[model samples]
Target chain A: MSLESVVAQSHVIVCCGSGGVGKTTTAAVIALHAALQGRKTVVVTIDPARRLADALGLDGLTNEPAQIPGLPEGSGEMWAMMLDTKATFDGLVRRYAADSNQTEQILENSFYRNISTSLSGTQEYMASEKLYELAIESDYDLVVVDTPPTRNALDFLEAPRRLAKFLDHRIYKVLMLPTRGIVKAVNVAAQTLLRSISKVVGTEVIADAIAFFGAFEGMEQGFKERAAEVDSLLSQPDTAFILIASPHADTMAEAQFFAARLRELKITVRALIINRMQPSFGDNHSPEDLAERYAGTPLGEQYQCLAEAQHLARGEQKHLLGLAQELAPAPVVQVPVQAFEVSNMATLQMLGQAMFDTDVTSEP
Target chain B: MDPKQFLTTSGVIIVAGKGGVGKTAVSAALAMASSSVGLRTLIVEVEGKSGLASLFNSAQFSYSEIQLVEPSLGVGEVRARTVLPEDALLDYLKDHGLKRISGRLVSTGALDVVATAVPGISDILVLGKIKQLERSREFDLIIVDAPAAGHAITFLRSASGLEDAVKVGPINSQAKDVLALLNDPTRCRVLLVTSPEETPVNELIETAYSLEDEVGVSLGPVVVNGVLPELPGLQANPLEAAAQAGVELQPSEAQNLADAALFRLQRTALQRAQLDRMAQELPLPQLLLPYVFTSELGPDGLAQLSNGLLAKIRDLPDPSRS
Candidate 1:
């Protein structure tokens, strides 16, 4: 159940959680740890925060995987990339189009230009597409994906099926057939109907739609096949999901909800990572006794603060315990709140080591 | 204007921040503060997280507004509700005499397609619902716990995006109205919330700039939540203090106290640096909320936060208006 073993065993590791819970940092640290252990690793991040680049000591990240420098000589290669949804979609169009002319037509279509990038779940879909592409085409031993914050994380998991459904849906095909000569026999009636629709939806908008779908006509099959491949890859035994969260009540609730949804999707959650845990005081003198012993002294105020900190720590422990009971049989790892943010390789290395040392499973 | 006056005058106040930055807690606190001052308040959550209900110690909230905290001083009442885009779409269709077809649309997945194909359509729907409620004048204030910072800018700009896409239509016209309401400083304001941390602070600054430059929304004060209190007269090292005081302690106890003090001092220093950055970079009013040590931030905790917020507001320069 150790993180090292998990990284060694799973080809695909998906880091998911609610927002602002250190998911990006966790994913980067895990990727670094895997690489340091001599596994070629690439961390793909969909986080808009740009923290991954900072953690990896890169000036910036792009859609292409850039190998990070300054690792130990014997360590495996580490690469990082940020998911650019628009670029990924454009790449897909370029790859699947019948010809460069068709690609030009599709790219120039207003509806395609807008929807390809700004669609609600388009980022999730593109992330899945990129991950699938990397898994099949790249030489990396492990691919770690940091997904978008909660709720959207589910969208990431469901993106392939959703895209496939959209492509195969009958209405879209019907709308495009008028432009593809497939309905030439009934062209007159369809033209009249389209005219009325265009009048309502604006003629230019309808034209753009028709052109976009027309350009996509022959590519639907390829899109669906790729979507299915991504779907299968995600559900395979070699892929694992990690649910990350802090011990805050809302975060823990969200993590649990996501875990349940992942279970419903038949995706096994390999581990639960609770980050920013309160620093434990261990079995030292109780805060209450310390408070009494130091009462009326100048240090009493300090004792009070210590007592409050301990109380908060205990509260966090309670929540962590509750989460453990709720997610029984899933190994839990607790990471204490660091005094400084994990911004560079040195801090990330320390964090990775801390994470490695804290992989204790709850009693079943 | 002071925070209280800003809250009273603006019809819609959006509480936005990075996720897990206590936006919900701040929104609830603001609503309670408004309600206590006798302004009819409605706190709305659009993320479908039902966080407001939990903050209020309730089980769940439907799309319809329900009374959450009764108003004091006979001003008005406080209510809470959850709004989802799907529900808004159904409501919109029902209002347009397509009630029967709405269910069909949902069942056949046509609604999902429409929501997806049109960028920001869901956001427009949610904002459209809020606009409708604001026009109804049922509440004096509507506090929205908007999406996290990155998506929030998109959510706020949905109206303009729709307006640009559909130049002329009922939807476009509605977007125009929403845009006008959002741009009017007297009608709408955005309060950026951030925990005293590097990531959240950085996000707050970026989001604040975008809110102004992209959406044309007026920015209000920034609420810095979970700030650590400075323990006055404490030395840099507590162990050194204890040694100077000639106090005897076991190794474990000494180590525990020293660790605790060091952690607090480090956090306090970090918080100060972050706050200074906010003040230097943003140039907006800032309010600090101390870190609450409670295990659960239930209704009582929210009330305490509300009082703290009110105290901070009172300390600001009073508004010139009546």
Candidate 2:
């Protein structure tokens, strides 16, 4: 099946690859294509560059879904949002807190303030949370996500499970105990752990962490349960992981690694979109053919540059061909290295058309 | 600036940029440029994914340094190793004489807790290690291939963020020292790399502003990587050129070459426009790295880039001893 078919069937499209692989633009392009096909779509991006917003014809994106302007009038609609990790974490806090006071207690805690915004997996967890929210609550037929630019591919995939485990941690349970109730005999294992951490990070930081977990007592269950939901939703059959990769060896290795990781999670890459591939032009006459055809022409002088260019293209394809074969059954869509990037609606739409019009096939 | 001037004056040059912008490759090339001039260089890889070891075909370097690219004729040397947060924290504990606690921190899974519960601990640990390296005066130049742009901001600001969070303790004092190293222009400078594209240039500008305003780190010349090389006579008709050279081309051959030429011309124009915008927007001296037209930037491609870097650095004005 082509990417168009994947877009038609999948409810959640997770665009993931290494950073600077044009993951955001590819996500936006897929979402736009979905919308044009009369499927109401929402694209949730994490910290989009200004040009992505410009391509979507918006001043900028926000935490809340803002309808994208200037799409061709159609039955389907398009909305875009940039995930604010802290805001999403705060919303989760508010949703789970027993009352306003408890909410304030948890939110005001210094440790919560630090981890909600700066904790390694906070963005990934919140992005997944937002995706679940849009998938179930919103009326959109499809929800496409632009994962955070995390170098570790495992971070986005592991965030929900990691959070759930954190909520269920023995250290967390030990920290949740009242400050006055920490007797010597109580939680000897956890006490020893805390003593070790305190020596290195200082006891004041531990006290803050204890207070942080103390305030988060009643809300842990909600968070753990929600994280569980996200973990399952991610592996659902209707969810597609569209991997966007460039032709370089590094990014190709990254994409291959990503695909292998997804396989471990039982999620196959729905479509492998190889972006910015230099076409070999071997589809036309070979340089040998050209040389033979025009032995005495001025074009013979130009063979060096053209042949060099062709060699470069062949090198790119060599890497991509391996990626395509490994990610079998996923439609391999090759978007040629364009003369221009997607800057405006016209070009964006042009890209959307080009995505499907190009070679969208799968040998597997 | 001469290659010597550029290599010797800089203490720790942190090469950072958005992912896929050839930041790692730039870091490797910078190390090559230094070692070529008989400068002992150490390239510190953070997060452990920069592919630094692969460029040299060396084995994966751990927390400790290993000889990566051996010098030719005893003139140059490049050693590389990784500095991760967890490993740095472990070393940090040992350095502070908490060797006993270090073992428990790992066995009890408290390392993750300490790193996560206390904000900026992870980053500070890594920076503190870098600070230690600088203090050792081990290398003529220390090139830290820092994280991509978004995390690069947090990474640089982590010391200040820690100082704000913890007013007293070893962590706070450690942050103070790291901040000292970061703020001192002579000690450390951030060399930002970016492609000649809209998004990368945009991210680099914002990261530069944050590094200056929030982190107070000195900025070096912005490296415009992947700049398209211009070719003469790109606009001329391929058929006419072919005819002029006393050879004729089939229509299809002419068409294929024409299409490739047009794409090249347009890419050059677009790159030139973006490069101009960058000069006006970010008022910093820029060193342009030509786009290597190879498939993979292996040792050969990196050699070319390394040579180009030295040539560009020489054209720059010598740094004043501030």
Candidate 3:
């Protein structure tokens, strides 16, 4: 159940977890490992924090994948990129629009500008689309995706569908139909309601919405088809999900929920990564025995603290063991908390080694 | 201004930080501290994560305010509630007599489009609801456990964004009101929480700057949570101390002790460096909450954190008196 095996078997690997769980780092290291093992890999991350670039020893990353600079020459290649949601949306508009004029109209529309860039789920949707595009069209042997830090991990899976549904709804088309003809066709009550809404939300917002929808009129089919492709790409057997979490109760609960939800979506979760676990000092001596053994020594209190640390580590292990039981049959890997921050290649390499050093099926 | 005075005077306090940094716990502790000082405190959470309920050991919290801690000599009076954006939208629709269509819109996913398609509209609604509650004066203090850092900035800027988007309307007027409240330093305070780590600390600094520059909201105090306590005299070496004490230790026991002390010392050093960097960069009042050893942050754990926070607040100079 090594990460290497998972990488070898799956063409697409999606790393998902709540925030601050080192998900980006995990994804990067996995990609790095895969690339070093002679599989051309690209890690696409959505973290605006730019930790991926830092991890990959790059000054910065854009929407396009840039080759990582520092790795010793290996058989396979490694490239990393950050998802620019706004740029990706703009690109999609250009790709789907009938002509440059239509693309310009859609891009300039105020509603489209707001929703495409700053909307909550737009980034998730675009990330999925980008991942699907890379998986299907790009030349990489493996594609690793670091998902958005949404409260519910399932939002990543639902975002594209939500966008497609919004686009395919009848209201957009009805609102955007030629003004006079639509008014004549609709009932008086509905027209009056529309007038009131325009007045309430401002005519400018309504006009912007109408123009955006009108410009997007012919592009709905393309968007829907792409959404379906991304959906299938995620659910297909070639894709695998890796759920990352820390040993904290709240995070573990989230991981468990995400695993169950992914299962419900019919996506296979190949592995669970428990990051930043406190290393156990072994069960040879209890804190009480240590305290008794070091009585009247200056190191007594220090020994007591050590015992407490051991106890905490054991407690964390017990909690993780419980989680393992809950996620039975899904292999679990544990990464111990490093003394130093992971800002350099050495630390990342060390982390990768430590991460896979254990047998994934064994109790951590 | 002093942290204590800021807490005493501000009618609304918003706690924000990155995820897993104990923002909810800090918010709950702040609520407890405020209530203990005789303020009729109301803590609100918008994520609908039930973090507050679990922390308070309550069954559940709905959209309505419920009494979490009744007025007592020691604990004082505190109430908790949750505000979901969807429910807020429904309430807004109900106020406008469009309640009948609200359910259909939500069911068909049209409501989500309208809420999200308009920049800052959803956040404006959430803040608008909080503003209404503040205006009602039902509580002496209101604490909102806002979303994580990146989105929290968006939440705080909703007022300004709305004002910029809508020129003349009820929404515009309401946004103006919220903006006034937020811009008024005396009425609102923003507290940033972070665990003593590199990533969270970096995020705290960035978010603090954004809160000031983008949202025009001045930060009150930075709360650094889950800080590990440093063991005395173990900074240099623990093995030397054991050897100096003439204690014969087994190889495994010695190895364990060294490993434990090494982790503690290393973590303490890291925390100190990050805290120092934060102080140097941010130049704001900061408070540190010790790491609670408990596996679960239940009521007792929260109480311990509350006491630590209250002590820190009390230590601050009272600007009003001066």
Provide the lDDT at A320 for model 2.
85
**Candidate order (lDDT):** 2, 3, 1
> How high is the DockQ of candidate 2?
0.49
Count of clashes in candidate 2: 3
The prediction achieving the highest DockQ against the true structure is 3
Q: Model 3: per-residue lDDT, tens digit, B1-322?
A: 3434556677899999998889989999998888777778898888866467888888668887799888876555788887877787667755665665666556656565566556677678888899889889988889999988788988899889889878888779878988988888878889999998888988999999988998888688799999887767454355676787776667777777777777888888999999999999998988899888755687888989988898888777677677
| lDDT of candidate 1 over A1-364, digit per residue (tens) | 6655777898989888888788888888898999999989999988646554776878789999999888988999999999988899999989998899999998887778667656567788888899988888988899999887755569887776777676555545655566677856554544454454444335666666656666777888888888888889998888988889987877888778788888888787888888888775654556666566666554665676678788788887777777677666777888888888767778889999888787744323
- Output per-candidate TM-scores for chain A, rounded to 2 decimals: 0.89, 0.90, 0.92
Fraction of native Cα contacts reproduced by each candidate: 0.33, 0.44, 0.42
Candidate 3 residue runs with Cα over 4 Å from true position = A176-192, A288-297, A359-364, B1-6, B108-110, B236-247, B320-322
RMSD in order of candidates: 3.3, 2.9, 2.6
Candidate 2 recovers a fraction of native contacts equal to 0.44
By DockQ, the better pick of 2 and 3 is 3
Candidate 1 regions off by >4 Å? A174-203, A283-297, A360-364, B1-4, B71-75, B93-97, B233-248
The segments of candidate 2 whose C-alpha lies over 4 angstroms from its true place after superposition are: A175-189, A192-196, A282-305, A359-364, B72-74, B318-322
* TM-score computed on alpha carbons, candidate 2: 0.94
